[model samples]
Target: MARPQRFDTNQLLDAAVRLAAAAGPAAVTMSAVATEVGAPSGSVYHRFPRRTALLAEVWLRTVESFQQGYLETIEARADAREAGCAAARQVVAWSRAHPREAALLLYGAQDFARAEWSQEHIQRADRGNRRVHAALASLAAALGADGPQATERAVLAMVDLPLSLVRRHLRAGDPLPAHAEDLAEECTAALLGSLPMAPSVSGSRH
Candidate 1:
């Protein structure tokens, strides 16, 4: 039987994430990841062809993980207000659970050298973004948001506000308080509530 490989892809990526979180993307090197995990450089190279590829994988992995849970929260709720609040709460929950990965995400894609990314990487990022917009649009429709500013308002409530809450704690390297989730949910609800809902034909309340 063939000998099993000493290192797996996840191990390398996890190490890279730690480096990126602690010292930024520039700190994530092939040798550094190998050293971080005590693996041979050849093992790291086997999974990732270049430094850019390694960094890209690190970003893609972290973002996709976050998007998966956020999308699920939105999809499972029929009430737009409830779903929007849940989505906001999910941001804090995911960040608290994955502080290292979440910290890395605070660094913009440009910090990861998006200009050098492969077409596949670019496409994957675009797809994830499109999905987020679609989910937000659905929530906006359900919330009775109408008119030209509807989409913009939905994005601010569902994306910007919640992320700002999480980002404040993550950037400070502080643990999110027990009440942080509740605060995020409340803020999201309030923001969405402030927007004008579509006029009901029968003048029914939302």
Candidate 2:
């Protein structure tokens, strides 16, 4: 049998993540990743034919990992308000657990040369976005809120707001405060509680 591979794909991607997190996406070149992992450049190319592909894979891997936990947390809650709050808290918790990946997430896909991504990569990104939006819509419906305004509120409560908290501390290279999760949950609860509840309709009398 042939000798086992030395540097696996995850090993290369981990190095890439470290580089991107420390110095931004511009630092995640093929040579850089190879040097970071102490692997031959051919090993990276063997796994990812091009830099664009590597960037796409790294971004997708991080995003999908985040989305999986987030979706699970929100879906597991029976109460709409609780679900929203849980999701917000999850963002803070996850960021605290994975600071390097969190730093990589601070930059938008565009910053990773998304425009040069392949159709498959674009589709993967779109699918993740659609799942997130769908989850937000479900949360809005369950909360008795409808229309675009309600969806916007759900997005703000469950995603944007929590991410903003993560972004601020991560950008400053500061560890998230101990109160981060509590703060996120409280803010989300407050926002969701503000939605105007749909009025109950009564049957007309004869």
Candidate 3:
């Protein structure tokens, strides 16, 4: 039987994530990841041909994992308001569970050097973007967000608010408080509640 490959792709990606989170994106070199994982540099190169590939995989993996649960949480709720609140909570919960990956995410995708990524990586990133937009659009429609302003407000309540809450703590290298998820859910509820109610149809009632 052939000897099993000692270093798996996930181990390299995990090392890259830790490097990026601790020392910023520039620290995520192929050699650095190999060193971090105590594997030969050839092992990393075998899995990822270049530094760009490594960075792209790390960023994409983290983002995809995060979006999976977020999309599910929002879609599973029958009520739009509840969906929005759940999405906010999901952000906090995912971050708390994956603080290192979350920290790297605080720097945004551009920091991953997307321009140097292969076309396949770029397309994967675009698909994730579209999925988020579609999910938000569905939530917006369900919430009676007819106008651009209304839709924008809905997006803010569900996306921006919760992201800002996590970004601040992650960027600062501070630990999120135990109540962070609750605070995010409460803030989401408040913002969603404050949105103007959709105008009623103008009709004579019997």
Task: Identify the candidate with maximal TM-score.
Answer: 2
What are the RMSD figures for all models against the true structure? 3.3, 4.7, 4.6
Each candidate: what lDDT? Answer: 0.86, 0.89, 0.87
TM-score of each: 0.92, 0.93, 0.93
Candidate 1 Cα errors over 4 Å, as ranges: 196-206
lDDT of 1 by residue, 1-206 (tens): 99998889998999999999999999999999999999989999899998889988999999999999999988877667778899989999999899999899899888998889999999999899899877777678767777658767777788888789888988887888999889989988898887665544121212
Best by lDDT: 2
What's the distance in Å from true for residue 12, model 2?
0.5
Q: Please provide, for model 2 over 117-173, each residue's C-alpha lDDT reduced to its tens digit, 9 standing for 90 to 100.
A: 999999999999999878877677777677888778878888999999999999888
For candidate 2, the lDDT comes to 0.89
Off by over 4 Å in 2: 196-206
Query: Which pairs of residues collide in model 3?
Result: none
Off by over 4 Å in 3: 196-206
